[model samples]
Target: MSTVDNPWELTRAIAPRRYVNRMIAEADGVIRSNSYPSKYPVNGNPPTTPWAMDLTSLDGRFWFAAFDLDAKTPEAFEQASEDLGVLVRILRDTGLPHVVCRSSPTGGFHVWVPLAGIDKAVMVQLADAARAVLPTLDHGMLCNDRTGAVRPPGAPHARGGASTVMGGADDVDVLRTPTVTAGDLLRVTAAFRELRPTVDPADSSPTGPVDARHRAHRSLPAWGEAHMATVAGGRDPSRTGYLCLLAAAVSGWTLADVEHAAKTAPGMEHYRTRNRPTGGRERRTAAEAAARLERQWAKAQERAVLYRYAPEERAQRDLTELTGIVDVVDAMLLAFTASPGRWTRTEADLHDSTVLTYLAWLSLRTGSRDVAAALRSVAIATGIPSSTVDRSLRRLHEAGWISRRRQADGPNAAIWRLSGRFSTPGEHVGPLHDVTARPPAELFDVRAALLEVLEDRITAGRHDVFTRAGLGPTARRTYESLTTTENAVHTVAERAGLPRGRTRAALASLRRYALVVVSAAGWRRRRLDYRTQAAKKLGGKVHGALQRRELQYRDERDLWAWWQDHLIRKGGRRGRDRVPTTQAVLFRAEDERGGPEAYPLYPCSSDGRADHQAAMRFVRGGLLQDLRDLELAA
Candidate 1:
């Protein structure tokens, strides 16, 4: 039985590593002391098909982890066994996958693959294919869900969990890894949930043995082919506030449930480290001291924000002092700013480089779908290894970061959408619009109509055509009487069917369906000021850049150099501080011909995915190398 203090030790123990066998051997030296009789049922051979999935601890407070499995561990290594059952059911014809675990904190899980005679890779392929209809799942507050599901970079509980497949009953199977039980997940969840936001990072010294009870139960008497091993890789990580987050997902509790419990838990009410009850000043002297402390603290945070703040900030205090927390926050901010995505490096993040790299890989991979040389190009750009990339992707799928589905052909690329929930586009952790894109099918009708209107406008009867569209009737009459003698009565009345009070709604729908333009023209039709969404993000980046004077190589004089460095190639200069026009493409396709042969490809907007893929396919097939000299000269 795991408790609130060490809710994830089991996870850390079981997480996959480059040398998993070695790590398990080392952990066994000490795990024997905590061992107990198993309470969970075991389906070692997986009478039914099996699949495994469970959460991993990233920041412990801000993120979650997940992975999939096909076989159970030998024995005594049941970790996240129960959660695996839930994940497995989505991939096979099983209603619930069996779970196996020892205690529960940080131990890896083993799932018995179905006896379907499917190859290991094929089983994984099938499991990936049948994963939940959506590409994300909820593993408590920590979500190792789909990539590019934008969230506030620094916000907590931003990920949407793992990808959860939903289709046939028991499509996913859950076999035990080291012979543990499923209910243990619930038990551990309950225990950890007791403490939350109260566990201040400043006071959390989560680096020791937690003597919790071992609660295990197993029942698979009907199956004869069960094998178990006394392996030692389980538990996840610390779960103070992290535990409270799980309660919401496990019990379907409201955000209110999580927020209240976590925010007011013991050991963290004020969440102060060395300073306590400084809530209100007791005496005049204390009050003055408090004021000075506030000023100093504010200044310290500023210093921490600087890119190289680790030395000064880390030396200032221990974990118990709020200084430690200030330092951690500073680190998180820096990590977030450097790379805006699913995971950022920080002092508080879990010390699992593999997991972090895997998360980054997903973010890059998902967003670069249209880029032909995506994987290889990004490897060069970021200096990451291919094996690390491959492993991370495998683990992420197991954990539910994204889903894998069979392509229409032999090998299929899994399609991932960031946690498929209605989160405000980018309103995740810090500040970014993370809205889910609306499927194009739903907006087809509206878009089709709008396109017709645009095509008709080419005839040139009257330029100001809003009034005739029932958008600006009064304004329409004014324009018509002033511009041309021809009357647009038919056009005006036909569109006038739009409800009187719903002019704005109609226009909004049109815009959503890609049917209307929202320039000065749309404003005139709706009789509303077309306020542009605040460009806070762009402004913030610019402000930060200027303050740091980081643009050292900016081309202040040469226009061509400036255009290439930035993704722009057209338009006059906007100003020194602003980019003129972000025309991303510079040269036409095949422009290397060096003459009019490629001139027809002018107005260099890329052919997007198609052209790039053609180029890459040629490269992949060794065609590029064969014609390298000729192509280069052309």
Candidate 2:
């Protein structure tokens, strides 16, 4: 095979007859108008901008299969490069002809294999077979019909480079490459399956005696079984069914085992008849239904490789479980707070502690430590921004308080578990105090009330009301101590499991907002609408502070933009070095000026360029407009 002289011709030849689309990219590699059915130029010659094409033709036949290997970091890029070699070897072994290209300026790659017009179902099975062998393959690409368009070869990558042919095959004619037939794909799939040893469910004894760990590995965990059972009544039956297959795969079950279990499991009855057409007059035959199950099982096995449980993790899973919310709350309080008083030493410490407490409560309420919650949900519950919540979760993970099982994707939330570090509470920390006077059974209800109160306060112009109203960790505990009745400072301290000094300060802060009132009888929560009153009291000061912050942000943004322009003019230096140079200049000036407000654009130690990018996004997201609206309301 000889690479074509014009890559655009290759791209045109590969794209579907209809539904070719165009996409534009920003300087920073962010794509705009990325959705499907976008406008594509009529004349070929490959538009100056990036473009995408549907994988399937108008007739619903797949013309090619592509794998996108995205690498976000240098280490990942190196690994992806290695994996690319493995993928090429696999294809060569299967006697399949393919094309390879550098997908971006970064070390990401894309490999496209031409296929004769094949049914989508057969294409999917071929993709799954490849996925089982190559875990790094992007499963989202060819998994469904509505997967949207993919940037074709010869297109401009969003990340500031052209997608160019790789592997010294520039002379290869991509358009004339030989295509794999459906029969060839099926043969390759069978060869791939042969690589894995098959397990039989009917035989109690294997060739060798199975140990306890091996036996455990071959059966679904309690949680997996529960998730699988959800298929019976879940709104999204397909998702639950996939989860079941994933569970089976993670438990080390083979395709045969999964098929057998699906045939027998009560919750999986629907899987037995999945071969029925949407409105067909007759049901599919038993053999056809079994074949359908085999295909799904193969796909799930591929995806499950990423989530397989490690030996240590399997042992630690039991230790992560909690008996009830009380146990979770007590464990978190003990692990996060300082001894004797359960008090946090600094604001940052307090924030982490509060976030952990909230996550623990959520886990217990869900009857599992594996809590799948979005950052937004946690932010709303804790009265913090989503970014801050993310940071707090990372901190908790670093501190051995939690372990993230899976990162959130699309509509799915991240799954986190209270780790084995705090499995056993140190000792009875004293009678667990119920400051909200809420019954332990009403965990979610109390969370709803807290969210409502927080929303009202924020909407009325009081941001971070929890901290502003002296509801810091210590203060919140103190205030809760007085929920049932008034108490003296020392008594409140004891009830709140805090130092007397901390209790007194909390009471003073609460009293300032009239959230709690003090008299000769001690301090008690005010009977009035505290949320409304607090918002009213803090609105002016909060808005003024926000306005000042916005002004500073605008100044920094303008300065950064100016610096970029200046650097571009001076030496035309661009890409990675420019950002570090700009940040260095800003830092030097900040040192010379010597003040808290002097270098507002200075990079944070934890995240250098990311901090600057966030500031830019903050301005772009219309925070300034929101501030103007607030000012007008005032």
RMSD (Å) per prediction: 31.2, 30.5
Candidate 1 Cα misplacement greater than 4 A, ranges: 1-97, 100-105, 113-117, 124-550, 553-634
Q: For residues 478-503, what per-residue lDDT tens digits would candidate 2 score against the true structure?
A: 55456323456777766556678877
Top lDDT: which candidate number?
Answer: 2
Instruction: Tell me model 1's lDDT, rounded to 2 decimals.
Output: 0.25
Question: What is the C-alpha local distance difference test score of each model?
Answer: 0.25, 0.52
Summing lDDT over every window of 10 consecutive residues in candidate 2, give the lowest-scoring window. Answer: 197-206
TM-score of each: 0.19, 0.33
Off by over 4 Å in 2: 1-5, 25-37, 41-45, 168-174, 194-634
Q: Please give the lDDT score for candidate 2.
A: 0.52
